[model samples]
Target: MRRILIVGAGQAGLQLALGLQAQDYDVTVMSNRTADEIRGGRVMSTQCMFDQALQHERDTQINFWESQAPRVQGLGVSVAAPDGSRAIDWLGHLDHYAQSVDQRLKMAGWLETFAQRGGQLVVHGAAVSDLDFFARTYDLVLVAAGKGELVSMFARDAERSPYDAPQRALAVAYVHGLGPRPEHPDTEAVRCNLVPGVGELFVIPCLTTSGRCDTLFWEGVPGGPLDVFRDIKDPAEHLATTLELMEKFLPWEYARATKVELTDAGGTLAGRYAPTVRKPVGRLPGGGAVLGVADVVVANDPITGQGSNSASKCAAAYLAAILEHGDRPFDEAWMQATFDRYWETARHVTTWTNAMLAPPPEHVVNMLGAAGELQPVADRFANGFNNPADFEEWFYDPAKTEAYLASVTG
Candidate 1:
C-alpha cells in the first residue's frame, strides 16, 4: 500500500484521508487537537454540505446521518437590502443533505471512521520541523490546513482571481435566544443583507439537541455604524447597538425580532479576507514536495458559503488522481495534472464570488446599475458552486456571463 501522511484534522484533511484509505493507502493524520476538545465546542461557523458530496460520503460509508448527523431537505437563502428583501426559498423536497454539524461531532465522526479502518492518528503540536520530517518519511504529504499559522509554510504570492479583488474584513459571532421569525420558526435558512456600502451580514440557523437553535452569523464590510460598538465592553450595550443597526440598515422584516440573547462572549471575533495566494506546488526547504489542497492553496471569501463545497470537490479530484497512479512510484506529473484540473474548475466560482463581495470596480458598478440586473446574476453564481456539470460548462464557455446576463434581462 502507498503510505501517506495528511496534516490538519479539519474537514479537508479528514475527507482526503477517508478517500485514500478506501484504496488501502497507509494513511496517518496528524493534528494538535483531540476528539474531546473539538467536540466540546459549538461549530464556529455555519456551513452547508450539498447532496452530491453527501452521496460521496455514503458511497464511502462515511455518511454521518446514518450514525450521528441530521439529514434535512435543503436550506433557504434570503437576500436583503437596507429597504427590504428578496427570498429564494429552498424549503421544499430535494435530495437528502446535511447542514452544519457540531464541529466537534464532525471531527469525532471522521476520526472514528479513519481509525476503524486501521489508519493511524497522531495528536501533536505541529511545526515546520514536523512537516519537514514527514516530507522525507512519507511517500505523499497532503497539507489541508485552512487559514492559520500552520498554513504559512506552503503560502505563496499568487495573483488576485479576476472575479475577486482585494480581501475585505468580517466579524462572526454565535448568539442564543435569537427568537425565530415569528411566522416560520421551524425553518432552517440563512438571511443575508447587502447593507449598502457596509458589506453583508449572514444570519443562519443552527439546531441543538435541547430544541433551542443558535444563531450562526457574519458581519461583513466593517467600519460602519455597526463597527463602532464591536469593541464595546458592555454586553447589553453591544447587543443594543447591533439591534439598532439591524433596524436602521436592514430590511423592516428583521424589525419584528424582539429579543437577543448572547453567549460565549469569551470566544473570538476574528476577521478574514480574499485575494489570497497559493503556489502551483510547494517544495520543502530541505528537499521534498507535498500537494497543497483546498484553502491551503486558494482561500476564497466566505460570503458565498462555498468553502466546504469547494473542499469536497477538490478532495474527490485528489482521490481520483491517487487512485489512477495506484502502486506506482508517486507520479509528479499526475499530481500536478490533478491539481491543475481542480484549480481550473474552481477558478471561476471563486473569482466571481469574490468579485461580488469586493467593492465593485467603477466600471462594474456602472454596468450593474445600467442594467439594474446584478442581484439575479450574483445569486446564480452563489448557487451554482455545487453542480459539477454546470461548473464544467461554465469554465469552458467564455461568453457564459454575457449569455447569462442577456437571458436574465430578456
Candidate 2:
C-alpha cells in the first residue's frame, strides 16, 4: 500500500485521508487539535454545503449530518439602502436544497470517523521541517492546513491571485432564537442582505455543536458600520455588537434577531485574511516536493461561502488523480496536473467570489433589478450560488447577463 501523510485534518485532509484509506492505502492524518477538542471548541466557519458538495460527501460516505442539519431550500436576497430600508428584495427558490453543519461538529466527527476507519491520526502540528521528515516516510505528503505557517511554504501565484490584501473584515456568530424572514417564515433560505459599498450579511441556518441554530456572517468593508467585532472576546458581547450593527445597517435582520443569544461561550469568531491562490507544489528543504490541497492552494474569502465546497471538489479531483496514477510517481508534474484539473472548476468559484467582493457591476445591478420582477432570473441567480460554474455562462459577462435577462423577461 502506498503511504500518504496528510497535514491538517480539515474537510479536505480528512476526506482525502478517509477516501484513500478505504481504497487500502496507508493513510495517516495529522491535526493540531484532537477530536474532542474540536467538538468542544469554538465554531470554525459558516459552512453551507450545496447539493454538489453534499453529494460529494455522500459519495464518499462521509455525510453524517444530512438528517440532523437544517435544510436551506432557497436564497432570499435584499439590497439595503444606506438608511437600512430594503431597496430590492426577492426570493430565489433552489431546485435542490443546501445544508450547513457547523465545522466544530463536522470536523470533529470526521476526525473521529477517520480514526475509526483505521487511518492513523497524528495529534500534533506539522511544520515545513516536519514535512521534510514526513517526506522521507510517506510516498506523498499533502498540506491541507487552511492557514498559518505551513501554508506560507507555498509561494503565492501572482498571476492567479488578484488581491494584495484582505477584501473584507469578517465576523461571524452562531446564535439560537433567530427568527425566520417574515415573508417566508416556513422556508429556510440563506438570507443575503447586500449593503453595496458597506458589505454583505448572511443569515444561515445550521447545525451547531449544540443543535440547530442560525449563523450571522458579516462581511464588512474596511471601516464600514459592520466592522465592529475586532476587540470583543466575550460571546455575549460579540452577539450584542453584532445585533447593534445589524440594527443600524440591516434593521430587518436586527428585528428578526431580536431574541438571539449565543449558542455557547465559543460561538463567535472574528478575523480577516486575504484570499489567495498559491503554487500547488511546495518545496521541502532537502529537495522533496509536497502537494498543497484545498484552502492551502486556493484560499478564498467567505464572501461567497465557497471555501468548504471548493475543498470538497479539490479532494475529489486529487483522489481521482491519485487513483489513476496507479503506481506511478507522485511527481511535480502529476501534482500540477491534478491541481489544474481542480482549478478548472475552482477558477469559476474564485472568479465569482472575487466579483462579489467588488462593487456590483452595472449589468449585475440591472440583473438584480430584473430578478425582483422575474422568478426565473431570481432562481437562476439563487442556484448560481450552488454551482458557480453556471456564472460563467450568464453572470460574469455583461453581454451574457443582459441576453440571459432578456430571454427570461421576454
In angstroms, the error of model 1 at 146 is: 2.2
Candidate 1: worst 10 consecutive residues by lDDT?
Answer: 86-95
Per-candidate TM-score against the hidden true structure: 0.79, 0.99
RMSD of each: 4.8, 0.9
Which pairs of residues collide in candidate 2?
none
lDDT of each: 0.61, 0.90
Cα displacement (angstroms), candidate 2, residue 364, comes to 0.6
Local error of candidate 2 at 223, Å?
2.0
TM-score of model 1 (CA atoms): 0.79
Minimal lDDT window, size 10, model 2: 222-231
lDDT (10s digit) by residue, model 1, range 1-410: 67899888876789889988887789999877777666555454555666666665666676664444334433444445434554222222233444545445566768877888898999887676777788888888888877566577665655644434434555544456666555466654455555556766666554333333444344556555445644666545555655666666664434544455655543224445555657646677777777888888877777766677677777887888888877776555666787888887577656656556756555443333433344555444334545544544432344654565567778
Q: What are the runs in model 2 whose C-alpha is more than 4 Å off?
A: none
